[model samples]
Target: MAPTVLRLLLMLLALLPTIGLGNNAAIADTDSTPAELTIANRSIFTFHATFLGETPAARAQRATAVIEEALRGTDELKVSIDPLQNSYLVLLGNRRAFIVSPQDLEVSGGDTRVAAEQAAAVLRQVVDESGEARNLHFLLKAFGLSALATLIFLVLIKGAHLARRKLRGRLPQLMRERARQIRVGQMPLFDMQFVYRIIDRLLSLFYWVVVLLLGYQWLSFVLSQFPYTRPWGESLNVHLLDLLRYLLDGILQAIPGIAVAILIFFIARGISGFSRRVLERMARPGTLNWLTEETLQPTVRLTSLAIWLFALVMAYPYLPGSGTDAFKGLSVLLGLMISLGASSMVGQAAAGLILTYSRTLKTGEYVRVGDNEGTVTEVGMFNTTIRTGLGEVLTLPNSMITGSVTRNYSRAVQGRGYIVDTVVTIGYDTPWRQVEAMLVAAAQRTEGILDTPKPQVFQTGLSDFYPEYRLVAQAVPSEPRPRAELLSLLHANIQDVFNEYGVQIMSPHYLGDPAQEKWVPQDKWYTAPAKGQSADEP
Candidate 1:
């Protein structure tokens, strides 16, 4: 393995549980100290002995000094197990000794006397192991063992890789066949290749995991070979355990909130579904007289959105990290952006709502707004679409529509057939009654004119050269004829009727009357393309 990878493995191994030597690995010279003391980087104990009113820390220092002195001198070090006292003493020559307390050996899983013997044994081993000669020997032994462990780790990794390569070549066909067996409505629920690819990835992950574990075990074992690195191995194990415990604790703490959020989501979804169904029923005719089927879906959708939003808001506090400043800041920023950018949208939406509730404009209604007149095809939240009389569709913003004057031809038809009117000029020499009768006769000949209301004629103005006569008549509302077609027919009928009567229809701007009178003679009325017989023929 690469050195970087090994270093990473060592770090990772630190998090594992320390397995060797158990909890009694560290020893204390006395029972009064919580602070553990170490000799040559090896944990001795959490034991502290107070002597001559000295603190445990001071006393531990003194014990360490005696041990160092014994090691320096030629005097042999001796560990005497004292069973009655439930402790062991390490003596230097005949004068100096340090007591190793029962609490120190208690971690080794033994009674006080047994612990005392264990402490004595460990002390003798430590004294012998502390010399330069033993250290060099230990260092060399550690390197050799580390090399062997590394070779074993490499072999294991190579095997795992070889196994993985073999599986990769063979597993795809097997995974694909398994995936093909699952189907829905004769369609494959999952792609065979996709399942195979996922299986391959999982296998690769498993191989990597095995390699990492092997590297970790090798690193831990190598560190334990030398006294200087033994404590590091122990700490690595402790820290790994601590990290796992922390992760488990965090997951446990978040479980209740996560569960609550999920429950809220499901409940909100159910409520939305139920409400939509109820609204649909209410939208049917006779169920709720005020609610129209057209408005039902939009209302349901808006209501559902509101319910979901409310549910999320209520559940937000229960979500992990919801109370964090970052989440709050993000929420505030989004709200601010919407408020700033949605002014026109809000106006349009509000206008749409107004249009809906006020019944100003509805689908299928023929209406004129400003210069654009058409049949309203749809009224949406932001815009209203109308197909014009000219076959052109115009999409106008709802806010703009709300601000304009709207004339509904359909509504006018509902009350009284919409009036179709035209104005004409005649010489003042023509009798007023005759002019009125002639204009009304022109309206009566129009195909779409409603006869029951009767056509009316009025002298709208007395111009400089003529009398302005206005003819008004209601068109049949149910008639499917266009306004232009109806007006064209009316104009043709008026011209024919005037020609048969020999009364010329002049304009107010005429400078003088023509030499032979501008009216067409009855014989010449159906000239050329005008093959229809004149009004006076029958």
Candidate 2:
């Protein structure tokens, strides 16, 4: 029993040193267990720490490790380990915290208990210098702000779209009302109102353009915030914005030209209105003989051209290329081309101007030019247009028209008066006196033949089978339908009168008859037909 006890005592004595060493190492490493550390004056304590690299995931893991380390041991005044804190405790003494210098691991103390406890507490509270919590909080706040901004942008865009739709729905009615108001306003200021209308439309168009640009800009900004579209959005926005800006610049540059054009339009409209009124007053019955002359048309045309020319001079510099060297070069080139190719064009134009001032013909006039007989339809600067009796239109160069002989039938009288001449032939057996009487009576019987002019007959020639007699009489010019009727009536009257004297009138063409008797007086042999009996009686 004594030998066994001695062996057991020796074994217990050897295990005691190992257990004490283990306890001391565990206490030194403990950070979770509360410890009281104290420090002396002029002493600094540094807490040694290890951490994962600066990455979000690594930082998160480090935070977790620190928390785990803090909860490691339960000893109230014992030095404890906290892996989450990434630090080791250096308990000096007492309940006081130690002054720990992060730069170096040095410890000093007034008392052992206070220094140990202070060092332990200071180490437990150590934090990284990077301010990870502050950065995370800032990122969360930024995301919330961005989401709010996007929501606001969407609301504004939707509201603008709805407003535009409502405005569009009412646009037609607004236009009509504005137009009526303008029409009823002062006549002299009507042109100004028209210009205002154009400007208003342009402003509305510009507004829509700006709205679209803003919408595109907002969409691009929003897309740039998204991970998928961020890169593409940046590039797309740059190019698209550049193109839109270029378009806007071009439109801005064109404003001067547009203004000049508007001015020209207003001036022309005013002049035309005034001129039309003047012409109407002048053209009233017996007021002015020259109002219908070709001078009036040319004068109006020249006045309008002068106005346009003045406007063009003002507008030329505002055009895209008008002030550039290219414009001068183009002018030179155009001059060369015109000199080479436009001689005929110039001649035609000059002739047209001359024709307009000559007052030889006007529209709706029946004209005979060279071999073509037609009605004038239009007279242009380069050519004259005529509509032929066959319903065909002919365009003749003014130069050609100037050189040709032209007869204007309508210009001879207010209503083109004409003479109707008929020729009748009869055998030599017909008496000349009787034939003259018949022709004269036939002219008097014809409807539309003028009585004041009185009909005349002449013996034209003696043919092989008959003597040719001509009957000429004046007719009313305005009666187009009566011309043919009068001619038929004249021929029928001559036939009836000639047949009463037993003379055959050959109209298809009569050659004098050699076997027929010579001409005689109508009072000697010719007798009237029986009452109610036809001249065809034998």
Question: Who wins the TM-score comparison?
Answer: 1
C-alpha RMSD for every candidate: 13.6, 21.6
Per-residue lDDT of model 2, residues 387-462, tens digit only: 8756578998888889999977556443555556788877676688888888888778777776766788999998
Off by over 4 Å in 2: 1-157, 175-211, 223-292, 303-320, 324-347, 363-365, 370-405, 408-449, 455-538
**All candidates' lDDT scores?**
0.73, 0.59
lDDT of 2 at 177: 71
lDDT of 1 by residue, 182-256 (tens): 878779888777777788789988988888778777777877777656767777777778888999998998899
| Candidate 1: Cα lDDT at 402 | 88
Residue pairs clashing, model 1: 14-236, 15-240, 16-240, 27-44, 27-45, 28-45, 28-47
Work out the TM-score per prediction: 0.49, 0.47
Candidate 1 ranges with C-alpha deviation above 4 Å: 1-141, 159-179, 190-214, 320-538
